[model samples]
Target: MSRLILRCFAVATLLVPVSAFAQFDIEREPINYLKGPVSDPISRLQMRLDEAEVRLTFDLKSGYLESVLKTLNVSETSQMLVFSKTSFQRNRINPRTPRAIYFNDDVYIGWCVNGDVVEVTAVDPQLGGVFYSLDQEEVDRPKFARHTDTCTLCHASSVTQGVPGHLVRSVFPDSVGNPILSTTTYRTTYQSPLKQRWGGWYVSGTHGQQRHMGNMIAKSSREPEAFDVDAGANVTDLSKLINVEPYLAPHSDIVAFLVFEHQAPAHNALTLANYQAKLALRDEEILRKMDKDPDAPRTESIQRRLDHSADLVLKHFLFVEEAPLTDRVQGVSGFAEQFAARGPHDKQGRSLRDFDLQTRIFRYPCSYLIYSAAFDGLPSELKAIVWQKLHNVLTGVDQSSTYQHLSAEDRLAILEILRDTKQNLPASWRK
Candidate 1:
């Protein structure tokens, strides 16, 4: 198991009370958004809100969702439904009216069908992920309530590497939307196998031979053995499992789930790296104040910590141990097509978003999230290491087994794609 996951389990075990979950102390660890160079989308949007530069027009004719979707450019086809009763508003969620989640590249918007608040999570170049909620009833101004204490109960746990970030889980849920705690729950990521994913979420795709824990509800039982997964295969539509009338999109797009499973951890790792860099710089300044050389080997304690954190992030960002696909998968809801269309293709019409669902997720082995703002905002010292490693690995200079799955053609294509489409690539990448 990864240290990141161990952190999540350790913290959650302490917080899960005998009857219910206890509040985690979030203010104890302050996320220094105020002190740092900030590029968080939500904070920027809030700035616009404060200046009256951007007005969210709430149409009572449509509802808060439509207005928010327009304001954020979050696609309707990006809708995903989860009924695990895991949110702050868990009481409002059930199998019939599951919470719907939608996302684009930069932000995720979540709403329970006819629920009170429209929840949103946005990325900050420095802050990783931050949570906010807008009142569905108060559509006049539609102010976002910045949540640190309440949302951090789950967001700031070890799941997010003890940082304010995002995570996804696969839980064994009963018919009433309660997760069965007796069974082992998976913190789903790119490294997680398909069969071990999507326990309480709706999935729409055709998996040739693999069986997963999605598309089915367990009866009142404590045993994972009670749940049969054969019924969960090749689920192209979810109308039989739940009422689709209340949701925005009918198909849950297995492609989208896979993308999310990969991107969430990638984002978390990037956030971790960003935070580590800031902390390192802060400590370096402290040493300078004490009349000590910050970068001197004797005083490089913080630098060593930064190096370890950078390597941890690189391990995840490089897909060192990504899960392999056993079956040929095809997605419903045109999600694959839409996702591919958004890509800034190279001269040969090649893009990182192109899918290879036969043996793996991406056509190229590298994660497209390397272009994310979090990565772009990485400290120069850490980014140098990442770029050098990327060049060596892609060029077969470092022929480790972890990246042996990448074909020569795949490497060349990825290299060309990065050179052409990705902005501000390292000079070393060309060699």
Candidate 2:
């Protein structure tokens, strides 16, 4: 039920935070995401493109899209189709010409047929979500539209925790891909239920006996319950729903969509964690100038705030509150198998990225996003707490029911994998 409150200013756009939850003045604040000396991988690529170190060719049917995916380390199998007229280029998007989104571990690419530009969102270690765009027309020289304030319109709202980040939304839409704004919109995360997902999008998958808001155009005046959801179940192809031609692949993989659902907010949560930690520590320095102690002798609040933020990030990293899949959820796309094959495993070849479609998102109750730059870029103090907490939970020292969802074998395997593969963990973790 999380939705961004968007409004159009004369020319500049604003990410209007939810008024009910009053917090920081995110709009006016100097977001470090935009304040980088600009050294993220995506930014570096942008520099290369601008300096003619790299050149991109425009293709007639987006052949460049396929090549670009390969270049970005994004997979072709990671495609998901959305037909919502809710993007910046709403005038160009429709159910008949849905936008195709693709992603891998840290990057997301968005494409629309006949659209003016291609969108890119990448995670930056120190800066959080870094957004850019490439013109989709005939061009000899290609440059990314990097760090524009307008993109923060939708990306940097309460939806993204007041930081420039990404989000996936589900909404009731009419025939034209225009969301039925009178109805409630859903900003999806891993915690979202299956029933309330995938509206305004075309999903091709098989979820046995489960119903969702996908594959149907909502009536302008009707409630969500009015549609026959069973009619949309088990859809493996999209030719019937729309002209699947003019797109890279005809399939809008459901497994990839589910993975996107889980990762988008997971990345945002990590970004928020990093941002919060940085600010807290920065404020602590100001306290030091005031001759106030951040510790108990000076101020007990410093440790408390840092601990709270770290705990929230830890909860998200471990998926402590992920919604259970009631039915045997399976996607017809080979994506599940393909995605599983690329994991970094333990001595026994198990990974946190392994999917458990029958119950929840993953076999081990840990997010692969923990390995992302955003998680790694957390203030060392906060990251230290996270690493220690992760070690405790994995080693059965902190076996609360919140994490009890993980089996003893799962924990042991995750511990072994992290200890062996993940560097800079607490030394006691290996012991």
TM-score versus the correct structure, for each prediction: 0.87, 0.90
Per residue, candidate 1 scores C-alpha lDDT tens digits across 1-431 of: 97567545543443332112112222323346434455666677767878888877654433478767777787787778898898888998988878888887778888887777889898887677778888878544557777767787688786777767787988888888888888788999988988889988888889888888887788657565476788888888789888887777888888889888888888877877766656555545654544445554423455565656666666776666788888888888887888888888889898888888888888876777777887887888777777876777777787878677677887778888889898888777765
The lDDT per prediction is: 0.75, 0.75
Clashing pairs in 1: none
Taking the tens digit of each residue's C-alpha lDDT, what string does model 2 give over 44-142? Answer: 776777788776666789835765686676777787889988788888889899989999888889888888888888777766678887777666666
For model 2, the superposed segments whose C-alpha errors exceed 4 Å read: 1-31, 50-53, 292-298
Model 2 clash pairs? none
Which residue segments of model 1 deviate by more than 4 Å?
A: 1-38, 49-54, 57-62, 285-304
